[model samples]
Target: MDCHNYITVFPERKRGQHLGREERGAIQQLNKQGYSLRAIAREINCSPSTIMYELRRGTPLRKSHRGRTPEYSAKRGLAVYEMNRMKCKRPHYITHCSDFVKWVVAQVRAKKWSLDACVGHARLHQLFADKEMVCTKTLYNEMAAGNLPLSLFELPEILKRKQNKKGTRKHKRLKGRSIDERPDIVDLRTEFGHWEADTVIGRKKGREAAVLTLIERVTNNYLAIRIPGKNSESVMAAMKELHAEYGERFSSVFKTITTDNGSEFEEFSKIEAWGSSVYYAHPYSSWERPVNERHNGFLRQYIPKGVSIEKYTYEDILHFADELNSRPRKRLAYQTPEELFDAFLDKLYIA
Candidate 1:
């Protein structure tokens, strides 16, 4: 047999693999056993230069009978390695965008803006430099990691929701025209003046006050009118007031109104006499009017469930509706509902 065939061969270490404590301990033991740097590198599966650098890092001078002797220690090597690791990490993005972070926190707490809304509005209007702002995903990640000052509970919409399976149910009654007869253009939200109507009640007991909400399909212009109670009479009274306010343009502005089978809108179909069409969603089917339902959920933030609506003044309710209308919706390309709605009205009146 050839002697060269009996020699042992060690594979080179892979790139980016760092030395562990066991490797450091092995190096210390090998050095003490009078092993050469190349022999230790072969044993540890690393480069000989790696061992030299580790020795320089782990070795310390000791005062002894021989005066100032250098000793290599695995413990010291690990300490230096950990310290460098702490220093080598990239700095957080928050450190560079303190002002933007402050503004975002303020908007969330004061204006109740969503994280995506803040990021979108800022980017659309060039409110901050590119480097000074982080993306919406990064903001959410930072919030999850507790780096942001805001809590997850404050953003109820962002939390994971459990989806209940939808089941088919027979309707006992439908008050007006079925949504089945509604035009496809209304569902597509391509036409202006189409609206979804609903009533938000407080304290389900007794005849307490309530709010009548109407949201336009195209512009998302939300209107909230306080009513004496959740009854057909009260709803019609509010409608009459709206007709008086809009006058001849009421029919053009409210071309269609879709609502649920709530008792408050039992006579809602009567509004069709005023030149607008009325349709009723299937019983137990709120999803058919999703936009109005979402806006009602947004309203719940200000007027919580089981709270008496009577406590809020008409002006206060109007203010809440204004806040919702003025918010920049991502679907609207960051333009506010009021802005788009006013532009549409201008064109209608101009014609």
Candidate 2:
């Protein structure tokens, strides 16, 4: 009969689709029955050249009475196709950037650096060539795919948070001036001396150790001091030490400080008499001092919640604060807070 009859028996193959095992088997059976290459191509909805190539690849030497003869095997064609596909896959960047990947893992484990910070710091310093490093998104993807050594828990501030209802609650009493009275310059974060203050407590029990935290609005320079307890007396004592440390430059360095109406900061307004303005946020409003709250979260990475802060020495607390200050921030153009803060101090003293 006619070769066109075979086309009706087999379903038409889509253009550019690779030949499957079933199609290959059909090619062998048709070719055995003396079907022309062009006729077989029409049957499978492929080109004549594709049939010719498949025949060459699928045909192998077969032993017979008249020496070795070539015969097409569907199994042979599929094996060769799979081998070629494996060889044609795109190479992963991890192989070429092995050194950079290793360094990233080390920093995340040893220094507790965020993946984005690691990538940004490396790019800012030109620590590696363009071909030798992947983007931060790729790094996180590799971690998710289990290609990296680090785990999700090791990353700071990467956990999901429960959504809470947002509303402003009125406080029974105001400890000091309200944040409403704070100057607009403080909100803009363009000035250098405006700061946000807060306290991190270890446990809810009586007389637990706490940490006093302060962060500059502009440079995000962080200062953390371990104190005896979360009380106004302890908070003022830390402030006194800071005032003494800054000495003549205290007023200029700490122009304004915004804090919450916590009992720990009840006596904090006294700093105004020492030359700096103190503004108090509304009750249950932590967002008013976001920078300090965020840095306190970073501090939690080293000193976890519910654990006594007294377990860590004063030097350990200082080291944690220093590490935070030395970390590169994307908002700071990949520069460390310490670098920008020191530069600002230099300019202030020279003026």
Candidate 3:
């Protein structure tokens, strides 16, 4: 509709009429010379931009005549209208359009290909080549409506790649109380001091016993710690130091702690003097305390499990925590978790 925005190239000709051979010859000659597009356009009495586009496309002779020209515009419109009218009278046989559906399904089955990916590929590479065609989303709607035999939910099977097996400590042996006892406010995250905790294991082959770990919840932000041991005393001592160093930060934001039933957290009451509540996760659902699990994974880069943390200084752990906090998180819309945690604090009623 916006003719001014686009440089209309060739005027529409009668449907069967091709470009004159002489016109094609001229394009071929000028292309061989490598004359400036503007100079060629002036020689041919056409727009320079048109010449440039044609050259970029290797100067193929134009054959199709579809859109408006001063003479045939009305005829083309009427022809399109008649075709659509006839098409509307026919019963839909969308299942016959298996090629299109197969293409969509193939893309969905590919690795890491989301709906967004499918939509983008269809628009950029398929539909937009003919500007009049429906968009990818429109195609999806029609496909869904048709209820073709293809299952949209089933993605193609990727080769099964083995991942490092995460170790699970026996929760039954963990000394901490069950998560059910945690206050309701902690669940809502409306108040601070409720934290989820976990540990990230080291590399494959059980190389080290170093623990990169932390305790944090909605209201409180915590720096990571490398504990020398996985015992209850080591965990309790690290938490005690965290509370002591960040007394105000802890008092305000640190209200409750939730952790998987790891025996490392057996001494749950070590920081009870800090007035923070604590609870334990159920069996096999450590994702319930996502923050701790997330931070634990991060610590794997530094003080991984099975490694000796005894060799690393407190400063080393502190710096690692700094880097971890600085790293961007997708959950925070590319904002660093450190920034999100701080912003969350400013919004909370700190004690």
lDDT of 1 by residue, 94-153 (tens): 779999999999988877788888999999999999999999999998998899999886
lDDT of 3: 0.57
Task: List residue ranges in candidate 2 displaced over 4 A.
Answer: 1-73, 160-165, 171-173
- lDDT (CA) per prediction: 0.89, 0.88, 0.57
Model 3 CA lDDT for position 199: 57
Candidate 1 residues lying further than 4 Å off, grouped into runs, are 1-17, 29-72, 151-154, 159-162
The model with the greatest lDDT is: 1
lDDT of 3 by residue, 1-351 (tens): 667767757654343332243444465577567677777766666677755544444433445686542221223333444566688875444445555556556655532233344445555455433443434455655656756344443422122244554555454554566776777776675554567776554443433444546545552344666666566776777777877766766756666667777667667656666777677777776766766765565465555456656667768778777766654343434345577677766766352
lDDT by residue (131-160, candidate 2, tens digit) is: 999998888877778888777898855675
Better model by lDDT, 1 or 3? Answer: 1
Selected candidate, larger TM-score, 2 vs 3: 2
Off by over 4 Å in 3: 1-174, 201-209, 219-222, 302-311, 343-351
Q: Which wins on TM-score, candidate 1 or candidate 2?
A: 1
